[model samples]
Target: MQIISALSEVSDRYPALFVDLWGCVHDGLKPLPGAVEALQAYRAGGGVVILVTNSPRPRAGVAAQIEDIGVPDDAYDNIATSGDSARVAMFDGAVGNKVWHLGPDHDAGFFDPPAILSNPTPIERVPLDQAEGIVCTGPFDPLADPSDLRPQFLAAKTRGLKLLCANPDIVVDRGERREWCAGALAKLYTEMGGESLYFGKPHPPIYDLARRRLAAIKEVSDAGILAIGDGPVTDASGAMGENLDLLFISGGLGAVETGTAPGGDPDPTKLNAYLAQTGVSPTYVIGTLR
Candidate 1:
């Protein structure tokens, strides 16, 4: 874990970056002090930066929300979210022709403007037997355990459904609540003989697409890309999953034991352990974006 306080250190090592939102850049509503400035500086130095996030909403919607929260649009080259990837899989014919919805009701609006499913949501499996596939947005019960959705998952599998997980996160922190996400359902379904294709971080397809997006705006390559994120699981895993150099921010996901430091506390030892366990190690580990 390399402790860096200056943006120059980051730019010298990696010219193109994939930065995570939420825990790494801002909370839901506010941007951190140096985060935006660091990003601004990174861009000024001939580097291309992309805000790659696990946001449940589509890429455009998530970008709008970030702009609303004050992360200057000029700070990065592009934005990609899990929801955006989900849109691709939802519409991609290879995935399936008909679909079944297994997520929150708020997500209904995403299906419009581009007809994802011919039938209105809460689409029955019986009708979907010959349809495209399954679209999982969230857990049937966010409050229930990860195993709670086992029954429906089995039914979906029995129907020979191809699963598309909109949110690759099994659990996410919404302020203080640890809510189960579509990833949990996907994992369970996979265990019960259902194959789940995830659309967010740690998945190579999305990573490659994000890189191409950056390339479109600026000259970029894999070696020059550095992924900075707050969580060892989603953000870190996403970067590592794609075999990119990574910087793990300690304060984002949970107050994981950061070595006792003022303004920030990140336990480098814990990070090492997580990296070893996941078979993915970050190139750098910092307490915060600063």
Candidate 2:
């Protein structure tokens, strides 16, 4: 893949850009260097920037985190998260309304009142054994091992409750460490023969919704849209599935496997092989978004 120094080189080719929020724009703790500048520059050049994230929290929740982390308001045109998409699905009656909320209290925003569910069936939160389905945002504790959820998943499997995974990211970088996500738990559930539905990156619904949002801001064909992200399983695969050009940023989650040096230099051959192994070939590769 060709390595680019700045997003400016290809900014003119696409009318819209779908950028990943966590690894691409920032880590969980703070905004990454030059990320905001790159986005501002892209919008200034007339490109519609939509921050597409695997975050299980709704737009409002994600926005709060973004604000707290100091991501400037003008960096992008809009934001969309897996939680927003999952809530839409739940509202459309994709899953039973009576569900168990499985993530931390911080993620309770996904199910709490004042956050209305449009279905005729009343939206209710029940105990795990009494629920018809489950909604998992992520691990209750980011530091906990996914294996710790196996017994609970087995119980759900036996009871035959559908699982709605708000985020399809298996893991994400949180400052200097990696944290397990809802997708990881969903994987465990599936292994135990449980039925699970995921909404987020690498999933078509979120991408389709994102495309429509981008179209609303500025009309652009899928080919005229560029997807920028750092993860292969989520971003690269999702972009390819949506038929959009991809810009893969190095030094994110797979830094070690890609032979990205501590100094921020990546070994091109190793990086390409890692993508190849995942069956993803990005249109371009850059060490950073800048």
Candidate 3:
């Protein structure tokens, strides 16, 4: 992978960018330094920016959250979230009518019907034992270990209920604190023999939704699009699967492994080792979005 100092060095090559949010643009609690400016600058040059995120929130919810986190509206053109993709699948009966919601109250918005579906299946969130399927936005507690859900997952597995994972992220750094995501729960469920359906990064459904969102604003092909993100498993894998160029931000989740300091470049040797270990070959690597 080529280690670049800034996004401007390669921004002109793509007509559109599919950018990840949590690590590339923000640190969960606030916008990352230089990220907003870079995106805004790219847009000023007539490039389309689509915030393709694995967030469990819908597009509007993500927009509002980012706005509150200080990422302005002008930074990007549009957004496509995993929650929306999974919600569509949920309402289409990917999960049965009655589902047990396994997440915090803030993620209750996952039940909100998408406007695009004219006649969606009526869904009801019932108790775990009474439900036909499970909709996991995340753990009820982000800081708790995923193994704690084994008992519940075993019950679901015995019942043969499919799990619809809203966000396929294993974890995210909220400032300096790391927390588990829905993917971790889904992963555990699958390990215990329960089927888990993912609709986020490294999966096809969210990418399909992102393309549709991009198509509404611009008609750029996969070759004309660049994917920027920090998660090797999620972002890098997703970009590679979709045959898009990826700009991997090493300083976010892999900073320790890459020996990247804040606002500094990653050590080439360490970065290479990390990439090799993860088995992800990104087109470009940056310490941060800038």
Candidate 4:
């Protein structure tokens, strides 16, 4: 993989970019340094920017959250969130009608029906014991360990209920604190014999949704579309699986492992080792989005 200093070096080659939101564009609390400007600059030159996120929040909710965190409206052309993708599956009866919601209040927007579904199945949030399936947005407490849900998962597994995972991110750095995400719970559930369905990064559904969103604006071939993100398993694997070129941001989730300094490029030796260890081969590498 080639290590580049700025996105501008390769931005002109791609007609569109599927950029990951957290870690690439922001740290959950605020926009990452140089990320917003790079996106805006790309857009100014007639490129399409789709904010593809594993956030459990719906597209509208994500838009509001990013704007609140100082990412301007012009930073990208559109958004495709995992929550919306999972919601479509949930309402299509991937999970049964009565589902036990295992997440915090902020993620309630996930229940909002998508405008695209003409005859969406009605979903009812019932208690775990009475539900037919589970819909996991995330843990009720981001700080809590996913193992803490073992008892609850056991009960669900015993009943043979399927779990629909909204976001497939295991954890995210919320400013300075790392917090668990829905993927952790889904991992635990699958480990405990409960079937877990994912609709986010490293999975097909979210990528399909992102492609549709991109096609709505402009028709860019897979060869001309670049995927940018930090997660080796999620971002890198997803891009590779889809046969799209990837620009891995070594300074995000793998900063420490790659020996990347804040707002700086990663040490080339460490970055190579980290990539080798993860078995991910991105087309390019950058310290930050800039």
How does candidate 1 score on lDDT? Answer: 0.72
- What lDDT tens digits, residue by residue, belong to model 3 across residues 1-290? 78899899999999999999998899989999999999999999999999999999999999999999999999999999999999999999998999999999999888989998999999999999999999999999999999998988899999899999999999999999999999999999998889999999999998998999899998999999999999988999999999999999999899999999999999999999999999889999999998
State, as a TM-score between 0 and 1, how close model 4 is to the true structure.
0.99
Clashing pairs in 3: none
For each candidate, what TM-score against the reference?
A: 0.84, 0.95, 0.99, 0.99
Taking all chains together, the TM-score of candidate 2 against the true structure is: 0.95
| Steric overlap count per candidate | 11, 0, 0, 0
lDDT of 1 by residue, 1-290 (tens): 57565556767778788988877777666786678888888888778888887666777777778899888898888887777767765665535656777777777754543343464333323244455588788866788887776666677788778888887776766555677778878888898998888878777767876877887887767788888887666787777677788887766654555552434646667756655765546677666686
lDDT for position 209 in model 4: 94
Candidate 2 per-residue C-alpha lDDT over 111-163 given as tens digits, one digit per residue, 9 for 90 to 100: 64324454345678888888888988888887899989888888889999888
Candidate 4, residue 53: the lDDT equals 93
Error of 1 at 173 (Å): 2.0
Residue 251, candidate 3: Cα error in Å is 0.5
Candidate 4: tens digits of C-alpha lDDT, residues 1-290: 88999999999999999999999999988899999999999999999999899988999999999999999999999999999999999999999999999999888889888999999999999999999999999999999989999999999999999999999999999988999999999999999998999999999999999999999999999999999999988999999999999999999999999999889999999998999999999999999898
Worst 10 contiguous positions by lDDT, candidate 1: 119-128
C-alpha root-mean-square deviation, each candidate: 3.8, 1.8, 0.6, 0.7
lDDT of 2: 0.84
lDDT of each: 0.72, 0.84, 0.95, 0.94
